[model samples]
Target: MKNSNTSDNKDMEMKYVMVIETSDYLHRLEANQLNLFTQKLHNGISKLLKKFDSQILKQDDNTYIVLFDSVTNAILCALKVKSNFKYITLKFDKSIRHLKIGIAHHTNRIAAQTLSTRMCEVVKNQIVITSEVKKAYEKENRNTFINKEHIRTLNFSEEQFLTNLMNCVETIWNNSDFSIVDFSKPLKYSKSQVYRKMISLTGKPPSSFIRDFRLNRAMHLMYDRKGNITEIAQQTGFKNPSYFSKCFKDKFGVTPKTYSKQHAN
Candidate 1:
């Protein structure tokens, strides 16, 4: 939030994390079991965090949020355990619901936009925790398990900078192909603008961020044995393997084949 040029490698400490109920559906579980369910979530999250190198802070309650040092590690955790959550009804004595999680580690304005934006799901209203909540918790010095004042606050100007920057990152991340021209056109900004925004939000330029995101997805798919390179390339928005390979090598310093071989083996 200060934008004070903090160390890029600065470790993630205990930061405020809040979970909001995003769905309109009732929790349905009995009061006694609700406590147990939250415990599962708390413990499940703790166990998941151990798989990554980052740190996590959880409290005695059913809710928990962690500050992760690496976005990559965070993403992996989010993806890996998202499907493992099961909510049960005490009366029914069966699992009846699940959860969708929203997470943010910084208190910049960009973090606010991420929470306020409506999710893509057409029918359901989305619920999210905002960066303002982080500020509020910090002001009260009551972040629970999260360390007090772990994150710095930002002013209006700094907030706007973060918001614009995160928008660019999301734009590139959502786009299937790393088509710089098309995505940049939406902002009516120059390629440099998009590039700078990407750097500010994700510590990388547009092409680089998109490449890494795609590669991460590709790895998951390859691990699942879901598709071959040609198919995966197309699915990820690369028109052909040659173009994908070139971009991949430029980022990873190796051809996809070699990279996959090294990682897979």
Candidate 2:
């Protein structure tokens, strides 16, 4: 098993996208029907690519992996597979199991099997071909996706601790109940101690770290409903709408209402 970046051809290897099983595919189909559907699925995927510069492997009965030459090719493959969710037909059956796709560029060093399982789990969580996945698939933004925000804390470089922190943060990501105190509660360190550790390691206060998270949430909610400024502020955990407005101005250099108006136009 080859890892993501370990494919040797760095210039050619953009990413490996895993097409995961998203439904109860075995619920109704007989073994022969299942085989037929799988064949159709494979042929459908191969047909999407204009130039077959990469390998498409049948990892299992249901899962497929496509190694594409570039991020554009990967995104094209992902969108193609997702679009087929509404179009694919079997020979004897009118419908088949739907699929969800997950894509990650070849940058990290993880085992191939582990990467496959993790990608499958991720694709299952994301039913759609998500905007994050789509944005990461862009040529100019591809580096930003895998590189820009990934700051590994050097002093407290414990994998389990980082994993736990990520899990806790992601679990309550959109919840207003998530705070620095809540994030520190399960870390086996006192609140102040955890604050100091994060500052020493990551060069910022824990509250400062999540400030961007909340601000980004606010921006996302703005796009969701173009005119609901106060409601978006409260939803992002800003108790004072005025203060939230100020923060938004400071970050994006535009007031929430003005930004909303611009987007609305």
Candidate 3:
């Protein structure tokens, strides 16, 4: 290894690096769906980064590595991206519901690379920063780091619970037979416990959550022009096309056929 003093000196250089990636569920989507989701995500992130004077150094599928000359801009960009995530994914058929961000302040490209690699472990919908970044941000701004609305970090148990819950939903969401019992089995939580926890966290009970998830997927499929109404309904786990059309109308204010025609390419 190189001398410790040399590494320290290199780290003293002024550069900020930010890494962003969507939830693990993105990898579970079909290729077409994945492309559509990432494209939308990238567009939204690019628009936000423009306000911060940052450059995207690299991007691989859903993961983006961004570089900034100013720590304040990097931190502000992270906060902005996190705040706008839901809006960014609003048009997606199956949304990328969360983003995990890691920000670091370093002197050189090598040190920035190392810092970004370690930040990959950050939890979903969370923003994590190095001590250097935290210090630099406070020095540049009058506000304390803890006072920021976007600085919230989930505890390990809460992170794990959300991860498991989301993974479970993604895995079984396309099954027409999927029910509250099926939803609870993978989580190992009883129906009532899962019900309360989901409501507390998402403000929607399990059944409504699953239904909304399905309806969202169906809407995306229509946008993609993936198939006719019947096939889209079946693919998204609705028991019948009529029921799917009714739900679609209830959620979207128009029937599926009308949506398909209006959005057709």
Q: Compare the candidates by lDDT and give the number of the best one.
A: 3
lDDT of 2 by residue, 54-89 (tens): 566455555666555566666555555667755655
Q: Quote the lDDT for 213 in model 1.
A: 65
What are the Cα lDDT values of the candidates?
0.49, 0.54, 0.71
Tell me each candidate's TM-score.
0.41, 0.42, 0.56
Sorted by lDDT (best first), the order is 3, 2, 1
TM-score of 2: 0.42
**Residue-level lDDT for 78 in candidate 3:** 83
Full candidate order by TM-score, most accurate first = 3, 2, 1
Q: Write the per-residue lDDT of candidate 1 for residues 1-265, one digit (tens) a residue.
A: 6665453334324333323231211222334555576666667666777876544433444333455544445445655455445433233322335344444545442442244331111102122233454444445554442222222233344345545544564556545644777647766678888667556544666666566667655545654457777887777667778988887666445666765554453
Task: Give the best candidate by TM-score.
Answer: 3
lDDT of 3 at 20: 85
| Per-residue lDDT value at 142 in model 2 | 43
Candidate 1 matches the true fold with a TM-score of 0.41
Supply the global lDDT for candidate 3: 0.71
Candidate 3: where is the Cα deviation over 4 Å? 1-48, 51-75, 78-143, 146-152
